[model samples]
Target chain A: MASFLEFRQVTVAFGDYVAVEGVSLALAPGAFVSLVGPTGCGKSTLLNVAAGLLAPSRGEVLLEGRPLKGLNPVAGYLFQQDAILPWKTALDNVALPLVFRGVPWGEARERARVWLEKVGLGRFLRHYPHQLSGGMRKRVGLAQVLIAGPKLLLMDEPFSALDIQTRQLMENELLRLWQEDRKTVLFVTHDLEEAIALSDRVVVMSAGPRSRPIGDFPIPLPRPRDVAEIRLTPEFLRLHREIWELLRGEVLRAHAGA
Target chain B: MRGLRVRLWQAGLLLGFLLLWEWASRTGRIDPFFFSLPSAIAQRVWRWFATGEVYPHLYITTVEMLLAFALGTLLGVVFGLWLALAPAVAAVLDPYVKALNAIPRVVLAPIFTLWFGLGVLSKVALGVTLVFFVAFFNTYQGVKEVSPLVLQNARLLGAKPSHLLRHVYLPAAASWIFSSLRTSIGFAVIGAVVGEYLGSAAGLGYLIAQAEGVFDTTGVFAGMVVLMAFVLALDALVGTVERRLLVWRSKEREGGSA
Candidate 1:
């Protein structure tokens, strides 16, 4: 079977400083993979390479078995920071991708309205990014990405800024959304619990200045798991301990270097 | 009702100031020759309106200001975005832009009047000079300061270069440009008025210059008052447009950006 996405021996460097080195990763069709790493582990750099925002110093990133050049058009990216246009209302922000593609304003707006409703922001369509809570802004960001219906989704520490409850709610919402269409998602996070809760496969990365995958664990948890409830299960606890053992060394190394 | 109360308070404050000024002038406590009584200035303004003498000059001044503002802002945004995006151009032009900005722009009024021959064109040319740098620098910063994450996200959502400009760059730059609006528009009015003062036969500035020549302090004061009101109205207009365009700025409830 053909892989949906592949990063072949990728390395990213800025001048003499290497951020990531000799890292390779691949995703199967409709797979959800979480990349777990310590602080400054260059997870974002890897994601950028996949998104085609940054070019690899070595090797190549392939999307759907083709060499991806410039930006990968088959994907949507959700950033850790609020990336919604502050000057545009929630509806307009969600409608932006379609508008950029030369869709008529009225039709795009209608579609954006529907997406906002799906994200539970229908009542606040006219509100700006500033007027929304952090959680609300995250919902807008989610709707903005999903509105385009991309083949792949790249999320970099997307829920790290949220409180635990909001984070779990967003994670559950994400899982529900993912289950419906099954788009390939590559999620980056420092949270082991989040990784275990949300992903089919959790790939553990070592700390920088030469970050690489140290372990890849396929989750055996049943389908449609609630992000909050799954944490209490013995199976989830066992997996957490196994992953944390590998991750703890890297986290300590990152802290000592910092 | 709250808005109305605020307006009423503002009106009362203005009336009180006028009354105090009138009293001081009538009692010969202050020299009315230079300061000019508020009543006299008001009477002069009222007479000009009643006799329909202010219309032609107001029309000419408005035309010059509007033309200069539109032309300067358009060129400013285009060139600013270009320079910011193309690093080579920016590197080459950095010192030159600084040098031009350093030159006291008011001195250019006589030169513009000389080149464009003391007409509306000359006034507009002078106005453009004052407005261009302000709009340019703000727009440059606006485009330069766009979050890398936002740009990457926009690209991953399938934005072309042109699409990026329309959807990402322009909207990002717009808030900065709008912030510069009141200042740049003030410069436009100043340019028109100054150009008229230096050489033109018409406009509010010309009226003040003519009054100063004949030693009619009331006419000069009336012209100044009119100019003040004119700018206030224009600034308010810009505020209205900004509110309409920047609707997304109002919703920042909390800091949860995912």
Candidate 2:
């Protein structure tokens, strides 16, 4: 498969403290890939580099055979914290990307209304981010990112703050959305099960101070999955066990280093 | 019911304080010549309103206050955004900004009066000097505190510099700006009144200053009463605008009554 995004020996260092070093990875178009790592393993650093928010100290990123420069133009990022503008209502928040693109207010609003309805927030078009529950805000964030229709989706632990039940629901929602178009996804998280459940492939990073990918595991699970139900399946358990064996050592190493 | 009780108590307290003052003056418990009776003050104020002698002064003062408030807020936001976004400029001007802010701004009233001549322009300049720092500090803090994640998300969403300013930076700073509205407005009023008291020929402050010159305590007290009412009205107006603009903030976070 042709690579949609390819990182060639990317290294990021802040002064003398190296966050990640010589990490090279690639994602095929429409592939759902997750980078799983222990705490402080710099999984997020790689995602930032991919999104072109942070420049790698060395090496380069090629997006669809071209060298990526500045911010990746065709990506939508869902942050770990509430990223939706607090001053805007749900409808306006979702419409902002289109508005930035010079879409007329009336037309953007009409499109936003449709998107909100699709995200099961039709009644909440007028609600602010603060008015929504945590899970609901995540839904809005998801809708806000998806409305722009980016070819690549970069999520940095987007649902990690939610309760387990809400997290699972969001994972399923995400899977459902991705199935519709299968835009290339680069999800970064510490939760192994979550990475395994949502991703077609899981890339694990070693502990930090110069973190790099140590293991890449193919999930091989059947698609259209319910994240909760899939966890109970034998294949899923086996994959989890296998990945955890590799991941446990890195996690211990990180803990000891810290 | 609790709110009604609180309102009633507030009204009762004001009524009692007025009655005490009236009694103290009428019975000559204090020198009535200096501390004029509240009834006399009320009568004077009513007569000024009935004959329409207060209109011009009221209009001038209001114009000065509004011009100062609007101009000060606009300049504050623009400069605040500029300084915050440009780190090098902010660093270079940090000491100058601090030194300027440290000066007792009231002293500038006389200079402004001399420069602009005892007109609305002088009063507005004084008011702007007083109002600017509050708005600027709030805006600076607000813009600086904007989440890195949010900025990255907007960038990933294809926000240009202009779009980020309009949608992200401005809105992020707005909450802080709104929070400082009452404080800045109070400064504006002080600027106008002080400018008038020091030199202007008209305005409520001029009326009070003139009464003080001749020892007409009733007139001075009447001017004070009118000024109090003016400030209260402005405060109420600010509250209405804040509620309207900040509808997206949760009521609880806004610290509104339950």
Candidate 3:
């Protein structure tokens, strides 16, 4: 398949601190990719570059065949934090991008209601962010991003803030959304299991200040795989162990540097 | 029911203070000339209302307040957004703006009257000056405080600079704007009244000045009471608008719970 998104020899820096360097990757359309590493391994920074939030200092990011000059409105991003507007009702929060795009209030609200219902938050449409539980808030955040109907979705440790049970549920919810939308996804996380569970390909990065991808592994898992089933699969365990083995030394190196 | 209880307690305290004042004045323990009995003030108020003379003065003050408030808030929001979004401009003007705000606004009444004349314009100018700083600082802080994470997420979602301003910056500043509005109410009233006091042929402040000159303590107290009632009503109106606009605020959840 032709690459839909390409990062060509991308490097990112903040003043003197180089976050990512000499990182190159290409994602096919409708592909699900995850970047896994210890904290500060520049996984999120790489995602930022791909999303065009940060310009690569020494390389170019291309969406399709064109250079990505700035942020791509055709893309959606879910942060580690829910980032829901605390003053907006769940329905309004979900409808925000539409509203900004000049959809009238009545129509935007109706569309928002449909998406909120999809996330099972229809009854709590009028509830504020603080009123919802952590899981519910994350779902609302998901709905907000998905309502934009972007071609590519970028998530940075989106489930890390939730408890184990909630994280599992959210992971399943995300997988369902991915299946339904068939959008290209670039998810950044530290959890090896999560990376294996959700991604078609997992990219592991070395520790910063000039971190680059050290390994990339493709998971050959069947669709609609359950968490429990995936855990028991020898293939899943083998991929998990391999990724962990690559990450462990880098993690130790990061600690030593710190 | 809880709201009712709170109002009942407020009323009770007001009545107790009135009774104490009435007893003190009637028993010759305090001078009624300076601190008029509540009953006498109420009678004066009733006379003014029955005669329909209070409305014109009330109307004058209200118009001045509303005009000043609208103008001040508009300027504050615009300038605040400019200062926050433009770092170089903020850096160049910050100290001067702080010094201007620190000067007591009441001291500007004479200067405003001299510049704008003895008409409603002077009062509006004075009121605007008083209301402007409160709103400006709050809005500045609000815009400045927008989460870096939210901005990053929005940018990744392909939000243009204008989109970031409209969706992210403005909403983040709204809560601050609304909060500053509560204080701006008092400033609006003060501005109008002080302007009238300095030089005006009309408004509640003029009535109070006239009453004071004539030694009509009851009339003076009645004028003050009118001003107080008007302020409270205006504040309630602002509160109502805030509640409607910020319906998604967590405080609204408390309202629903109640």
True contacts kept of each: 0.81, 0.89, 0.53
Error of 2 at A94 (Å): 1.4
Query: Residue by residue across B42-131, what tens digits does model 1's lDDT show?
Result: 899999999999999999999999999999998888889999999999999999999998989789877786788989999999889889
- Off-target runs (Cα >4 Å) in candidate 3 are A99-114, B1-9, B158-165, B252-258
Span of 10 residues, lowest total lDDT, candidate 2 chain A: A79-88
Go through the candidates in order and give each one's C-alpha lDDT. Answer: 0.89, 0.89, 0.87
Off-target runs (Cα >4 Å) in candidate 1 are B1-20, B251-258
After superposition of all CA atoms, the RMSD between model 1 and the true structure is 3.0
DockQ comparisons of all candidates to the true complex: 0.55, 0.59, 0.39
Q: What lDDT tens digits, residue by residue, belong to model 3 across residues A226-249? A: 765587788999988888999999
lDDT of 3 at B47: 87
Highest-scoring model, DockQ? 2
- Rank by DockQ, highest first: 2, 1, 3
Interface RMSD of each: 3.3, 4.7, 5.4
Candidate 2 regions off by >4 Å? B255-258
